[model samples]
Target: MGAVDRYLQEQHIDRYAFLPFSACRILQPHKLRNCGEVKTVLLLLTPYYDGDAADRNLSLYAVPRDYHLFFRELFAGLREAFALDHPGASFHAFADSSPIDEVDAAAKAGLGLFGDNRMLIEERYGPFVFIGEVLTDADIPCESGEVRECEHCGRCACSHEVCLSSLTQKKGELSGEEKAALRNHPLVWGCDDCLLACPHAKNVEKTPIPFFKTDKQYRLTHEMLENMDEEAFSSRAYSWRKRETVLRNLSLHGE
Candidate 1:
């Protein structure tokens, strides 16, 4: 089947878009242009917003399974399929660990552009989606999709003066003032308030079905983290520091 059918069946994706990227060419030189070369770009889309399911705790992204783990496995499965078809071909799936610039590559492939909010925007999924791509030697297909721009959005300046990503990764312990930032940080692992403030995202369909239809609400509760020991807490999401770190952040956030 083609990339379209593959995305639909394999991914169980009701909604998706494919954008071909020239990441290999960007990385390689002028000489080895086509010498036994094979490569294709694959983009996967996942929705992570749950409406009205409020905990008022934990960052938006870390509420679910580790995306790095999920993306790595999914990309590996894709490469395995490629190897089966091409036999002697060599292939590998690059998670975020790759040196290639992912957001830039995706935008070049016609996925979308990075808005002033510093997030990729598409007509359907907006900015709440995680992007993963596969690099290979087998030549795949490409298409010209919509070019969505984010220049006019003033929310980034008016709001989100501080980035949530930087907030959580804020080194060691926190003081009175630093803890306040964590509470109003918008998210723990990542932030989407800029997207949430988008007028475009407001009118789009409400995450369709199973995307929002899950009892499998990925969330990290205070109680869940409170009981965990140093090792156990570290095993889960948002446990980036000693137990004191989360407690301090939480205490400040709750206040």
Candidate 2:
């Protein structure tokens, strides 16, 4: 095992893969400013599902605090360790705001199969894991794998325009038809309709990470939204749209 693998194991992060930069599809080259000549991509999977996430007004992923914050702290430590190991090597970490197509990279690395819903589905964590990566100039050994596809159950397929999760984050006023769709939508932040219909997502193991297990807000009520300040809103996954978006969703649902 390499230093990176040892560090990940110590951190209890078991799902990870190493691939050559040539295999990755760089979507945002502008994001890689100082990271010169990336030679390797280290893809990681951080599972957040804790089990039985029912009766939540937010998506299972959003029930916990914003994962971006978690990744920031995690990557800081990782980068520091890498810097110490290989002097002059550049290491950059990214989560949702990634330079490469993370899902595609993860699939190519053999971390999981591409689900029909366009999510990476690990056998244990299913599609509930967050994809993060560490891009480096160090020449790491690449894993031998290929892009694999899921069973394609065809249950989670839906148009992007009509997706309740997408509509909730959409800015400005919604159309009458869109309003009707969200009237009885379970979550005010993100939709789990697709995950709920996925067979592979059934009875998955709970996350061992304590950060996700504690300080969770499964149900964000109208009262909570009304009382939320900037600090509280910014700390959550659904905070990107601000409190107004959630409040509007709740009101439309007559909650």
Candidate 3:
């Protein structure tokens, strides 16, 4: 387990913690069925916020390429290396589609605190990070840290029901109230209002990860989307919602 920690640090993983499988809040047990009696979970945090964009029409998180693809490639190499070191152990990596409750597990591992906006707020990265995990059958010894609460600054008081980010991703026709809320919304894909309002999020350091800083698309115009093929679009984080959803949001923004 100590060697594993050193290796992960060398790989430039921002933060990591080892958690027992029993301590994790499993949401999708079937996803881990083939892992063969998971014993320990390695939680990792990868910060993705490069910087704020002045001409941004998309969420800060959506400006870069999809993190899901990055995690897939990363975990693949890690699994191969760990297999060489641990002869009979099994390791499986998961990100957004993880079986366990990622935020809860991360908090319990002493990685960060729960923000009022329902996001994991790491002290250094605020909420601008992606959580990933590696499940292994090895009984790695580790300490389960206490979960702490973030400062209730009331900045993220808005509920999910009225969240602009959630509203922008809705399919089909939006109601008059929804349309009105989005009329002057700067983001066509997601919102960053809560993050911007939070004091902990202020003056945060930009991501050191090179992947997030390269090939960024801060603003997405209709012409750009019109010319993009499926492959090009799929590379973006906002592409999961497809072109229709974004286009609809843009239209509502009076683009």
Candidate 4:
């Protein structure tokens, strides 16, 4: 492995698998061979904590700036920077999405430890973080090491409760079982019980940059959605999903 690749592997990729919450994935040289040769995986960290995020109107990811837009520009800059030095290879960026398992890739990258709740927890933000990856055809370095395990800590009781995001995503009236989960659930939007439960969340140092700070917190309130158009609503970290989905989630609260 080259020096650049070695440094990233030891520092970031190495922690991918260990974190209870992280985005873990590998770029297939073969996959990129078709494109350019699959070189480096550009990794990014987005902090979603604001010191106070409970009983919020939106999911944890939603309250912040739309990461999809934020990171696209970020990764593009990285590629441009790398291209200046190593113009021999090409790259691709992905903040990924709900449909893909980003946390799992973080684990594989050795960037953090994994919790039983299936989230990747880092030493700084715990599991309340967003990740982006850039797959490249240039050979750099890889963090193939395994992450330390954090599966059985049982320290945080958030995941055990019914999750609000799950309920809301269902897009309809919740069943008695689902409602029970919500009453006992830790959050109304994205799940944070597991995040709050992690030991590393409280005292981590803040990033020097301001872009990583999320929206602080924003719930999918009825008034906000009812009054605004989809274009406006889509601007938030909250994905531009349909209004009915959020409405059903709010219904669980009977408000």
- Give a tens-digit lDDT track for model 3, residues 122-220: 888888989999999988888677778888989777644587988888888899988888886778988888877888887777787777888898998
Better of 1 and 4 by lDDT: 4
Candidate 4, residues 40-105, lDDT tens digits: the string is 455555655554544565556666667677666665565656576568666656675422356665
lDDT (C-alpha) at residue 77 in model 2 = 78
Find the candidate with the highest lDDT and give its number.
Answer: 2
Q: List the residue pairs that clash in candidate 3.
A: none
* Stretches of model 1 off by over 4 angstroms after superposition: 14-39, 141-148, 158-161, 185-189, 203-221, 228-236, 240-244
* Candidate 2 minimal-lDDT segment of 10 residues: 1-10
Per-prediction TM-score = 0.73, 0.94, 0.92, 0.73
Choose the strongest candidate by TM-score: 2
User: How do the residues 1-255 of candidate 1 rate in per-residue lDDT, one tens digit apiece?
Assistant: 754457346654443344454443354333234334435666655555545346545554555444565565566666666566656555545555553555656665666666766566766766666666555565556664544567685875535455656666666766666567677664444455667687655654444434334433344445766766766554445555556665555555552
Off by over 4 Å in 2: 1-3, 159-161
Instruction: Estimate candidate 3's alpha-carbon lDDT, on a 0 to 1 scale.
Output: 0.84
The lDDT-based order of candidates, best leading, equals: 2, 3, 4, 1
The CA lDDT of each predicted structure is 0.56, 0.85, 0.84, 0.57
When summed lDDT is taken over every stretch of 10 residues in candidate 1, the lowest stretch is 27-36
Per-residue lDDT for 31 in model 4? 39
Query: Which one wins by TM-score: 3 or 4?
Result: 3
